[model samples]
Target chain A: MDTLNLEGTEDTPKVILDKENGIFELSGRSLPEDSAEFFQPVLDWIEEYSNDPNSETVFEVKLEYFNTASSKLILDILSDLAEIEGTTIVWYFHEDDEDMEEAGEEFSELVELPFEFKTY
Target chain B: MQTQDLILIYEGEFTQDITKAVLSMAERNMDSSGEESSVKRKVFNVMVECLQNISKHAESFDEKSKAKNNAIFMIGKQEKEYFITSGNIVRKDSVDSLKNKLDKINSLDKSGLKELYKEIIKAGKLSEKGGAGLGLVDMARKSGNKLKFDFEPVNQKFSFFSLQTTIHRS
Candidate 1:
């Protein structure tokens, strides 16, 4: 498919999903007022990408903070990625951000995908 | 010495722009005070939940009745901890469900809260308002405190609901 890139804002995250380049990452803060609306295209892209996913799909999530509303969308994204084989999640959190780390753990527990946790 | 400082206070209609501004103001306040990164994250997260909760109170206001459309948000810093509080108008019919949710959240211990949070996140369906119903649970887990709330009937159809969440500095 085509690459989907979005710039981060005060209330949204930076998204870079490139199936050709093999880069699927979401970074920065995510606290959109309407998370379902904001993440709709991304979800659609992931659904489309799953059909022709790369051999070793690694998705990186390096969000500093996300609202509970966005949390559900994050789960939706992760669940879509889980359907593809050989997919893994690289969850990054700041050394001082225990909440982010725990968030990664909770997402890992919810999804069947393997997660590699790293501290920045 | 014990001192209580009011960091931020906002009272008006809760819009998306207001939510962003409120969060950024609270974030800057925490930054200026030189709070630890962990504590600052906790405060920020709780504030988002509180503010969003107010935005979800759409039934409290109707175009015909303009008297009950406003909400209040305040953050105060004490010597040992910081507190985030919010009050909004809600429909009388929602009072029972809202109270039940808060009471259930307050009754749980840390581990219990964590378990409940996981359970809800895994299975809870999103409301039309795009809420996963995990805001209160996440707030309790993040602040590591019991959720305190009150409801006062205003007329026969609406009630004023106030909620307070506390985060420790340590």
Candidate 2:
């Protein structure tokens, strides 16, 4: 398994997925110049990880903000992660942000895999 | 119908610069009024989303033109309501897809739209061009009004898309 390193941009976030340790994170804002181009690699990485089969995968997302296009990619990533065997997903949000929490819940509602939503 | 409210016109070469300017303006001066900041934030958010739609999905307005990235965004307030307008060129193939999505969204009731949004979410089928189709639905729900749109054809293979949304003062 190979690690993923994507430098952050003004409109989009930095996504670092360490394939060796199973620590994946998406942090910062997301309103990419083009959603498909930016997200395709991440999708590719997860597709590879799904085959390797990890016991647990913790995802840390501290996105100060993300746009509608990015929202689709994030959900797509979550959905893909949900399909792999023996993997666990956890999401964290700001303590006072009800909207973010709701967004997380809405995503959790669709995924069949086990997910834990936490407020920090 | 320009009364006493401030008017804004953004004609620029890049979408990010203009969106940043507007967001900063709202962030800095939103305290001047008694309106809730969240209300102001929502209005600004929708406008940005629409602009994102343009920058990503819109068709190139010109072949020989150097300002292909350029777009127009307008904002104004009237009678305790804020109006935001954004325009950009889009391809012919994009027109029907966008229209169908908007029409479908307009037809849904509150709960129905929610269900549809979820269905689309779970189905995980993405827009051909990578759009989520969630932005307009969120705008419809937030504004509490049906979304209004127009498509003006530039030629056989291209057209311009204009979207207008308003949020009332709280």
Candidate 3:
């Protein structure tokens, strides 16, 4: 599969999905006016990547903040990844950001995948 | 109408650009206030949700009102808290639904609100505009306070809706 690399902006996150490298990451803020539209392609890529399956896949999420709309799409992405074996999710939060830490916990509770929480 | 502690007030169209401007302005204002980073982030997050709510749900003015995309956003600081308020015209038919949503959010305790937030996200339902309907839940959850709101009838076809959330700088 082709690598999916999208630059981050003030309102959107940077998405990098490299199936060959077994590395998938989403970083920065996500509050797009139309989240479904912004996330559809990312979801499509993940769905495609799942068919072939990477031997060991790592999904990293480093979000500063996200709107409720982006939150649902993010959960969808994580849920999709949970179906594949050998998938690990690394969630990053700021040191004093309890909200982001709690958000990571919530996502971990909802999805059946290995989650690693790291603070910066 | 400007007041002493009013940091920002925007009236008129609520576009994506305007939302960015508002967020940046609010961020700068919060930064200068010498509050803790956590409190600033909370205020900024709530402000984004509030602005997006207006942009997504606010009713555009019709011939009756002669106001195009009429909306109002205000941020004020009072003692240990920052008050974020937004008002916009909405379709009369939506008044009841909005009221019920706000009332339900206001009724929940912190844990209950957290549970509700998780449940809604798990449901995976998005509005026609691609919203997860989690804005109200988020505002309530982050503020650690009750969500305040009011709806005033405007003619027979529209109602002016107002919502306020507070962030404590503790």
The pairs that clash in candidate 1 are none
Q: State in Å the error of residue A63, model 1.
A: 0.5
lDDT (C-alpha) at residue B87 in model 1: 85
Instruction: Give the distance in Å from residue B53's predicted Cα in candidate 3 to where it truly belongs.
Output: 0.7
All models, DockQ values? 0.83, 0.39, 0.88
Candidate 2 ranges with C-alpha deviation above 4 Å: A19-22, B1-4, B12-37, B57-64, B77-81, B89-100, B122-129, B150-161
lDDT of 3 at B163: 90
lDDT of 2 by residue, B1-170 (tens): 55846567777665666667666675555556655755665675677677766665655667788775566777777777877787878788878988998898889887787787687666655577566767788777666667889999989888888888888876
Best by TM-score: 1
Report the C-alpha lDDT of model 2 over A1-120, residue by residue, as the tens digit. Answer: 779999997676899999777678888768765687889999999998888766777777777567667777888888898787766666777775555666777777877767677777
What's the true lDDT of residue B36 in model 2? 72
Residue A35's lDDT within candidate 3 is 93
Over the stretch B1-170, how does candidate 1's per-residue lDDT look in tens digits? 67889999999888788899998888887888788888988998999888887887644456476643479999999988998998888888989998999999999998899899888877876789888899999999999989889998887888888899999998
Compose the digit string of candidate 1's lDDT tens values, residues A1-120.
789999999989999999888899999999898899999999999888888888999999999889998998899999998999999999999987888898899899899999999999
- After superposing all C-alphas onto the true structure, candidate 2 shows an RMSD in angstroms of 3.8
Docking class of 2: acceptable
- Candidate 3: lDDT of A78? 93
